[model samples]
Target chain A: MQPDPRPFDEPWQAQAFGLVVHLHERGLFSWTEWAGTLSNVIAAEQSDTPTNAEYYRCWLTALEQILAQKKIATPDLIDITTQAWHRAAHATPHGQPIMLESDPKRIEVK
Target chain B: MHDHPHDHDNNLDPMTARVRALETILTDKGLVDPKAIDAIVDTYETKIGPRNGAKVIAKAWTNPDYADWLAKDATAAIADLGFTGRQGEHMQAVFNTPDQHNVVVCTLCSCYPWSVLGLPPVWYKSPPYRSRVVLEPRAVLAEFGLTLPETTKIRVWDSTAEVRYLVIPMRPEGTENMDESALVDLVTRDAMIGTGLPQVAS
Candidate 1:
C-alpha cells in the first residue's frame, strides 16, 4: 500500500535526536559541549554545503565523540556493542523483540 | 514498533533491522528510552509533514525561482518551507528531465525519504526492489509500470545511511493552468520516489 508521503525520517535519526536530549537532561554532557561539537561538525560540513542529512548526521557524530571523550561509551565499546547487537538480532526470532538476553556473547548469569 | 508479547508476526522497524538492533543496544545501556524515541518519531512523522514534499514539487513546477533555488540548494529551500527538524536527513533534489530519469533505491537497507515519502511500502523494502533496482533500473522501472523510451537516460540513485534523495518528477503536459495546490494533488508518493510518474493532467 502507498504509505502517505511525509518528511523523510529514519527511526534511527529520531532515536539519535532524542538520545541527545535525554542524555543532556541526564547530565551526561554539558549543553556547551553538545553545541560546540555540533557547531564544529556543521562548520566542517558547510564546505560541502549543508543539506538536511549532513545537518543532523553531525548529531550522531557529535554524540559519539562526546560519549567517547567522556568515556561513557567509548568508540571501541560502541563498536563491540554494535556487533553484539547484530548477533542478538540474528539469534532472536523474526517476530520477537530482540533482547540483550539473546546476545550470544552475554556472560552466563550466576 | 510494537513491543508486546502478542502473536503479531511483524517486527518493530522491520525496514531498518540494523538501527532497531542498535536502538535495542542503546536502550539496554540506558542511553535512551524506547517510548520517548517512539513518541519523538511519531510526533514528527504525524505532524503536518506529509504534504511538504508535494508542496515543494508543486511549487517548483509553478515557480521558476523556487525551482532554481531547489536545484541550487535543496536543504535551504526545503527549510525555507519550514520543514527543517533537528533529525538527520540531508536531502538532495533529483529532477527527472526529458532526457535523464532518476530513480532512488537503498541497496543496503530501506533508506527512503521517509519523512517526505512516508513509511516505505513493503515492496520498497523487499529484496527484489532493493537489489534489483540498482542493477537493472530500466527493467525495474518497467515493472513499476513506468515505461520510458530507450533514449531517456535512467540514473539509479542509491540512498545511503548518510543521505537521502527526493525525485522531482517532470510536470505533466496540459498542467499549464493548474495552480500550485492543484499540482500538489497530482504529485504521488511513487512519483517522488521515482517508481511512478505524477498523475497526468486530468
Candidate 2:
C-alpha cells in the first residue's frame, strides 16, 4: 500500500519541508547526507525523548547542524534570528501573520 | 502606539526558534533567496488551500460516479485534478454518513496531504491532539465545536507518513441548489480534517 497522503499538520511543517528542499537546491547539502544526519538526530531523540511527538523538531535540528557544520551559519547568528522570531510572534495578533519585525537597535548588513 | 496583540508565550517555542534560525542563516549567507522562500510559502498559504480539497469534495458530491472513483482510488482521483506530490503521494477518502462520522488523526506524527488541503494547522499537530484524539474522538470533536449524536458512530483514521486521509463531510442541508463553486465556498479546512462541519447557511 502507498503511504498515507496527509503527513503534515502545521504550516511550519510545510515551510520546513520547503526550506530543506530550497537549501538542497542551493547546494547546501545532499539528501543522502541529510538522511544520515537526520537519522542520527532521530536516533538521538529516540534515546532521549522516545515519546517525542515533534517529528519536525528532529528535521529542524538536523538542518541546523548541517548549516553550522557547513559554516553557512554561525550559532550566534542562528540564536539572534530565533530570538527575533520569538519577539515577532509575541507581538503579532493571534490571527495575524507572524512576520519578523525589524529590530531598530540592530543594524541590517543588507 | 500599541502593536502588541499576541501574548508572548515564553514556554516551549522551539519550533519557531529552529525555523527562524535556519531562515536567518540561509538568507545571510546568500545560500537561499528570501523571495524564493516567500514564493513557495505563498503558494501553500494563498494560492493553495482547502479550496482544492473542497473542489474535490464538491465534485464527489455532485457526481456519484466521481464519488465512487474517489472512494475506490483517491490518489488517482485527486491526481486527476493535478494535486499530487510530497506528502500527498497517497490518499484515502472516508465518507461521512448520518450513521458514522469520521475524524482523522496522526498519533505517531502529523501526516497531512499538502497538495490538496495545503498545510495543517497548529492545533492539529499539538501533542494533545495527537494523543487525545485517538483515545476520545467524540470528546476531541466536541472540543472543536463539533457535537455528534450519541447514536452516531465515530471512526478515527490514523494517518501515517505513507497514506493520508481526507474526511468527506456530509454535505450540509439547504444547499441542494448550490453549484460546485458555491459548494466549494462552504467546504472548509476543518471540515476536510473532520474537526468541524462544512458551512451551513443559517
**Best model number under lDDT:** 2
lDDT of 1: 0.70
Per-model C-alpha RMSD? 10.5, 8.7
Interface RMSD of the predictions, in order shown? 10.3, 8.5
Candidate 1, residue B129: how far the Cα is off, in Å: 1.3
Question: Candidate 2 docking category?
Answer: incorrect
Runs in model 2 lying further than 4 Å from the true structure: A1-17, A21-59, A65-110, B1-36
**Which consecutive 10 residues in model 1 chain B have the weakest lDDT in total?**
B8-17
Candidate lDDT values, in order: 0.70, 0.74
> What digit string (tens of lDDT, one per residue) describes model 2 on residues B8-100?
433226675667667776776678886777677667656666778998999998999999999999999988988885432479999999999
TM-score of chain A as modeled in candidate 2? 0.75
Q: Model 1 - which docking category?
A: incorrect
Residue-wise C-alpha lDDT for candidate 1, range B1-202, written one tens digit per residue: 8566655322334324434544655676787787877666676567644467898899999989999998988878888987763435577899999999999887654566645665565566555777788888999999889999999999989875456788999999998988988888888878888999998743
lDDT of 1 by residue, A18-99 (tens): 5675676566776556766765654454333333444446667777778668776666766666666666767777676777
DockQ of each: 0.12, 0.19
True contacts kept of each: 0.17, 0.26
